[model samples]
Target: MTASASQGASSISSSSIKRDASEMNNMVTMTTRLDANATVRGRRRPPLSRRQRGNLSTLLSRRSPFSNETGSLAIGEFEPSAAPSVDGVARSSLRDARILVVGAGGLGCEILKDLAMCDGIFVDIVVMDLDTIDVTNLNRQFLFRSKDVGDSKAAVAAKFINQRCPWMNVVPYHGKIQDKDASFYRQFKVVISGLDNVEARSITSENPIPTLLLPNRWLNGMINNLVEFDDDGDPLPETIIPLIDGGTEGFSGQSRLILPRITSCFECSLDAFAPSAAVPLCTIAETPRIPEHCIAYAYVLQWPREFPDRKLDADSSGDMKWVYERALERAEKFGIGGVTYMLTLGVVKNIIPAVASTNAIVSAVCVNEAMKALSFCSQSLNTYMMYMGSEGIYSHTFVYEQKQNCPVCTTTTHHMSVSSIMTLNSLLQQLCDGEFRLKAPSVTSSMKTLYMRKPVALEKVTRVNLDKPLKDLMTSGEELVVTDPVFPDTSLRLVVKFTDVDE
Candidate 1:
């Protein structure tokens, strides 16, 4: 826990824990909701009004895969009781533990309701989502009513849950996750990511979470060895919580428990995800073969030419229709079949097949993991868990290893000895496309900008450093940030120990 005088830094530092106003806003909102919903318990259990019923039909009209021709939100007929007391002693955390659920979509809605039904930890359940209620979200997103279309999903879900279980307080934040910084994230003991964005699960942060769990002495030891901080630098410690991640694609879904810094972070195996396939311009333009090729041609080439000033949003029905029509036209010329408005929408939006059953199945596990982390009711998921309902009801749990040389978590800094005559350009060449492949590398030390690759202004200023001898330009034991757009996701942290070999 002690800060090293050499650099005013501790063993674990979280530069990523930057403050955000939304965190304060969410806290304040949760307080207000808890006070307001303490008594509104399910006093009314009426069926959906006429207007809500109409919206349900519209939701079904969208060529969605929901087999149900119609839908309705069923109000619970009985009052929800409090959670059973543990060991015959009432545990009030059921009504006091604050849980933040990010995303009010399919899995999000389920997580919110399942947690509410569990009932003891009902004090402050905050929900955040940037989208409004959509007809397409109706089949799986159980908390929304047809009448709630066009309303903020977070707000609607909170209101619905509060009305159903008056003692439950579901606070809603109708905003983007990026708007909140690390300070806001620290307030909650656990965070669940309900997003379908696979990339969100694995990106590395400058301030990782594992250090939060590191004992003070171990952190001190790790930092002393991994980072070379200057005598004058002082860095503050960061707060990190357990992160539960869930993803669903059609009938398949997976959930994982991530303990930042301590376990395999999302960035450790980012290479596991296959890079998206890009259609060659020739195949898309010259001789389109498959239906997907025709769609790509219209989407990639035709859209830009026809609507130069407009951005294509798959959410907009009009926009989706336009692309489908254009793609369909191209397909006709190429004698293609099996193109429809629904398929076009799916292609453009990258919509995965998700079912209500899968959302419920996956969310239950995520909630169980949350309860374990929050209440210590049972051992939390060792690491990762997946569910596949389509083939058969099957679930698998496993622990994944962090990448050995992960740009994010690895403390292995590169050590190299070079001659005094070695120039910055020479150092760059030495790295070459070998074990540590780097090209057009930009290097910087603690006190000075050693070199910058582009943006003429930066390049001009730092270009002088490139010709200077590496030994003369850098102070002994100073670390440098070697970066390139090639990796784009992680920067190389280097501590260059120079040797003057020009004897």
Candidate 2:
């Protein structure tokens, strides 16, 4: 293929590849794990010693994921064995590479392991986590043990990896990722996030995390805002950091390769996450339909009334138990079943049990993409991959396009022509019911806040502005900063250009 054609081919996202359960029956499989009494290659394999078991090089020497005897790399046949003429040089580069992992939970542990075990591809790893290991984390977060509970997750995870791979250096940061500045993040070659929260993942975009995959030509307009210039005035490719983000929920998971301003960012895809379902307060209080309604009632009404001074900490075991008990009482009263602790936690915290298998699959894909990004051993995912293991092993890879008016990545302003007589309510409706489809947007201008949707006191204060005309709020052509729950960290800029309308 020609240069342009090759670029196009590499960039195009592939259709969904389904590996049905029935298909596994037809394929021949080899069992790599030796039975305690089993022989391998016509010889009895001795039991591994503690030191030997911990040593990763002993296992990696037998087989590496990127290279096969046929000189083919799995998944698209991008041959790593062929790509690097001098294996020593490539391996050296990989050994010296530094990668930052932004979680030490289920997905984080798996990501760190996968990246570290990649046969000299990554030796310097930095893992960060604000949480301490809870007993609940032991089931899926394989790196932590029951004894390790109440200890810093990042420290324990690092110690575990370092003990196994003596040659590798794993640095642990036992603090919030927000505490670290750009200088701290810029040291790493790649930033791989195994974080569960969207806000933290979005914050990674603001940090030194890089974006790769998209060509500079297509993203010229957007990159100009983010890309740094070299001494010669050319855009510095080194300044563009690549972020490999992966998340798992239950039996489903996804991994994305992002290039911040140069490609589809985490903020650009915020619309994909459906907004939280709003239940009417009356239904929650007077009549309850499902078990979740009871939980909500207990959380929303009972908690605050009982403990006026204290705020509910969802992570607190005491708080969760109290809520669970109250919710259970409410459920029993309303003749509702299935109001268990797990369900209560889900309803209150809005989190599901992290599946170990799903985390492994997604983390492996994410680390693979990171390796490909650094080594160029294969084409990186262009630029999202979704894995569904609920039924069968199914995957869908697609290129997520960037939003033109993306509040985070782009400064593209929106223009709205409205009559001076238009009420603030009409403008709010236009934002919600119109093309923007914004939910509970708060409108503000350079002068004052025309309306606020949150903070009961402020909402009450600004409530009268709803029926006020645009003329009373501000002059025509005034710039308005429209904030919504959709874009949590940033606001949309809408220029209200006046237009004549006869009443």
- Predicted candidate 1 versus true structure: per-residue lDDT over 1-503, tens digit per residue: 44465345532233323334567778899998876665536454445576445432222123333222221211112111233333112235334456778778898898888887763454578888888886677777888888998899999999988998887778899986645544455567677767663321111132111211112112112222222334564312223366677778787898887665556655554454443334467766878877766776676778889999998776687877888899899999989887788777655554556788888888888987776565443456767787877779898988778667655455557666667668988888776434454436888888888889778999999888778887788865678888764333346787776675432
> What are the per-residue Cα lDDT tens digits for candidate 2 across 1-503?
69998777665532112344335534433233324338788788787787556643343333355432222222223223323322445566567778888888899999988976876558899999888987668789999987898899999999999998876789999986645545666677777888763311111112211211111111221222344767876557776677777878888889998876667777577667643334677778899988888888887889899999999987688999999999999999989998999888776655456888899999989988787667555556778898889879899989899888876567789899999999999999998766565657898999998899889999999999999999999888889999875553467899997797432
Clashes of each: 14, 5
Clash-forming residue pairs, model 2: 210-241, 210-242, 211-241, 211-258, 211-259
